[model samples]
Target: MEQPHFKSWPDVAPTLIAVAAGRAPADTVIRGGQWVNVHTREILPDHDIAIAQGRVAFVGPDASHCIGEGTEIIEADGRFMIPGLCDGHMHIESGMLTPAEFARAVIPHGTTSMFTDPHEIANVLGLDGVRMMHDEALMQPVNIFTQMPSCAPSAPGLETTGYEITPDDVAEAMTWPGIIGLGEMMNFPGVIHADPKMLAEIAATQRAGKTVGGHYASPDLGPDFAAYVAGGPADDHEGTCEADAIARVRQGMRSMMRLGSAWYDVETQITAVTEKGLDPRNFILCTDDSHSGTLVNDGHMNRVLRHAISCGCDPLIALQMATINTATHFGLEREIGSITPGRRADIILTSNLTDLPIEHVIARGKTVAMDGKVMVDCPHLDWPDHARRTVNLGPARRAEDFVITAPEGANRVTANVIGVVENQAPTKALTADLDVIDGAVAGDADKDICQIALVERHLGTGKTVNGFVSGFGYTGDMAIASSVAHDSHHMIVVGTSRDDMAKAANRLGEVGGGITVFKDGQEIAMVELPIAGLMSDSPVSEVAAKAQDMVDAMAACGCHLNNAYMQHSLLALVVIPELRISDLGLVDVTKFELTDVIKGSA
Candidate 1:
């Protein structure tokens, strides 16, 4: 893997000293800006920042002494000079775009730093996919650090991933140039229970002197949370409430409040710092998973910043949460977090702090974006043919393949259902009473209950597990299926009609890997994610347009939930939930065991 931070402080220390002392001319200078100093939580007007060798050399009231004819001077025009926004945690694959395309989409939005977990690809293509993502991320002008994915199946026996990450893989990835830490330890139960495999991965990361990311999804902040924290994870982005945030920060973990496409967690959690008067340094801002449409239409980290500010956080404090707090947590504070001397020149010029308008962005002392247009190249790696052909359905599925059989002779059954929670990651484990027709369970469209299945796309096993779901409010003989199922990367199909479900799953298999929506057995809209069956290498604009169409198609089917596609894709995420479907069966995540979809007679 290639290194993104090319200029070490030692490499430019002499030049920096010279420029600071006015002994040499600066390479670039941003003059007459109101510096939003995150270090002191203050905004100072009439400041100038001088850059040399892609690193800031001087930040003071005047840099005219270091100016020369060759020096490129940018007038900030009394704008707020904030550090380039940083996403403390995110997944590039969730956007249905590769690292290069994700970079292209977010650069103009003023996101210069990202801490990305590539577990979506890891579950599909393993270490090779992770290395590919890391390599492409380094090619971009901004800072995109890769966290070696710690879990593949996520919950060990609850689900089976296409590729499992091993302890040796974790250790090996730590030595890579771009890897900042171990990815979110999704198996919090494994940590609490002292699972050998989970401990070994955590030990390897610690031995390599890197951070261990965390995901404690349970609402319990008691003994389980303490045990998981003791297992060596450093930060958590799964916090959704004030208590969750406070409990995390109190235990020395940075509470990463996020606002993703479907996850609206920041407003609920930011109160730990704003209202509770806790130290804001331990609070971080992130987009845990923003899809292509969210990235192109709404901003990236800037969106989180504006939301945090709207939630009553001070603007400077919110910037700190998105920038320095993130960099400091990952031990990159000295390199790329701020505009201080000897740091990477990743700065943003905005006309205002509230409702930040990214007028211009500079990453590594160069003008990478201006007025919502990327001016630099975001490069792509040559993905192999095998990565494109990962979806292996074994054989075409039939409508009969998705039927949920009721217990023998039972006319009615109480079925466990996965309930979609709007604007959140966790789903409610609900149960519904439904009728059994021809010994098969039937979904009640009026009750908003529908059939859900996990199609085993890896290993060509021709296996599937059927279940039920609710809260999407879908109707009119529609089905939506995605190969981008969380953690396992299996194909999750949900629909009112078994035939339409079959059609949607077959459509993805026919295209190798992608998301497709079907109504009355006809394909309505689709987004082809041919890479690892999770993301596409296409330009973000094209993918976003197609994703919007998919959203529209879902709406046409009478389904309405904010980013329902995201909720649909996570139907099989066995790690973080109350109930989920896996290749084996319907998993009761609270118990971490497979339960029959059909219970006793209703």
Candidate 2:
């Protein structure tokens, strides 16, 4: 089938006239609506949008000329017509669905574009996984652009990835039709120090004239920050404070404030524009890692927009942050950000400007969603068998695997614990005194402390690093297991009882790869993430429903950390601050070094 393209308003004027005159040949024409022009931040009333052949042709006061028989005329009832939202930064695997399914989940939320990085999957399944995600994204009805993962191991020496992405990979991927730029370069220390590999990758992305993503996740806004700015990253989304946001924009970087499933960074950072009086154009909205629950139950980019507005930002500025600003950041301003000529006819009709109630959504000039229901088919990809079967436990993990042996004849000891922050991406480094039993240290659930272990699943190494975590508040005989551990994508299991931990890990292995909760030696909830142990082939709503059960299971165990699954996945990520676990060992992320959980600090 030959796809249609639009050039100018004049070319679509006749079709618009036909639609208004009840003689249009277009697929759909929305009439008598107020257009919320995100480009100029204006709401122009009495506008009509003419969509035909899956691309918008005319948007004007009247579309009575291009109308012919069989044209669908939609009366907007004087509502607000706005551009469909765009996510400036995200990860598809974090949603635990393939790109096609992810698109299907967010279409009803009025998200017409997404800039995703498949680096998490790349770390688990390599470049082949990136290709798989990219191909499926192109098949979606809405825009799903990819950023070639810049950091595979994320922190090179901190941990090992299943696959490594080189400078050559970035250069080669630049020619792919759907690749927008380089993914978030998580190696901030490497970039500041001018590491050869990181510099080479940045050079390749620059040579291709694509934007380079940044991640300077530190509180130090000193010389190191300057060094990172000189390293050529165009934008950063790790800012969590007003100072962080102000510094990034001052250093010629776009300040990307994100509102993910667990990351509530928008409110804290949007003050850079709302109070500090910075240029709003340099700010962007992104959902760095939103799970399917947030997408199906809450919203996607629309959620971010609402959060930005609630943080005292102007409604128009919030809309721009989710629209034209994001499009310009990725160099897609001419393609999908605005309602101007030559762009994809992706737009939304809403009832309220501040609340932004999405009533109708049009993608590429075709009405794809109406009243929160998808009206089209979102295609799926045939995932290979290798992606489904990834959990490799070299041997059975015994209770001894989780026992932290004390020094010599030491009876009890003080240990550094990784404290999970609720509904936030950052963790707190905490210390606690524990009682030793039978020459091994055990978790004190009364103090809200539990055992956390990271089992290396990449090469059947069978290496397990044992540690303790607080703030989960888990009591009794319950354990949680997940293969979505971040960065290296290893399996992380936390429990007060060693037997339950082993059972949970074993069940995931039995199901190929998934999350399982066990209490009293019985399974309570499970979600099969058969694709690279990070995503599922099932519909997002189904996965989301199961995810709710997993949440309930955690709560039933007497744990009360908000969105603790997010905290669970990040336990293995060595990039974020305070303390973390990895295949290598427990990492003191602030110092970027391996430290023992019990004593022997530094």
TM per candidate: 0.99, 0.95
Please, what are the lDDT tens digits per residue for candidate 2 over residues 221-310? 999999999999999999999999999999999999999889999999898889989999999999999888888999999989998998
Give candidate 2 misplaced runs (Cα > 4 Å).
1-27, 600-602
After the best TM-score superposition of candidate 1, give how far the Cα of residue 187 lies from its true spot, in angstroms: 0.5
True-structure RMSD, every candidate: 1.0, 2.9
Candidate 1 per-residue C-alpha lDDT over 1-602 given as tens digits, one digit per residue, 9 for 90 to 100: 55555667887899999998999999999999999888998899999999999989999999998898899999999999999989989999999999999999999999999999999999999999898898989888888999999999798888888889999999999998889999999999999999999999999999988899999999999999999999999999998889999999999999999899999999998988888999999999999999999999998999989999999999889999998999899998899778899899999999989989999999999999999999998888899998899999998899999888888889998988889999888889898899999999999988999888899998988997888899999888989999999989999998999999999999999998889999987999999999988989888999999999999999999888899988888888888878888998988889899998877899
TM-score of 1: 0.99
Check candidate 1 and list the clashing pairs. none
Q: Which window of 10 residues has the lowest lDDT sum in candidate 1?
A: 1-10
- Candidate 2, residue 312: Cα displacement in angstroms equals 1.5
After aligning candidate 1 to the native by TM-score, how far in Å is the CA of 106 from where it should be?
Answer: 0.5
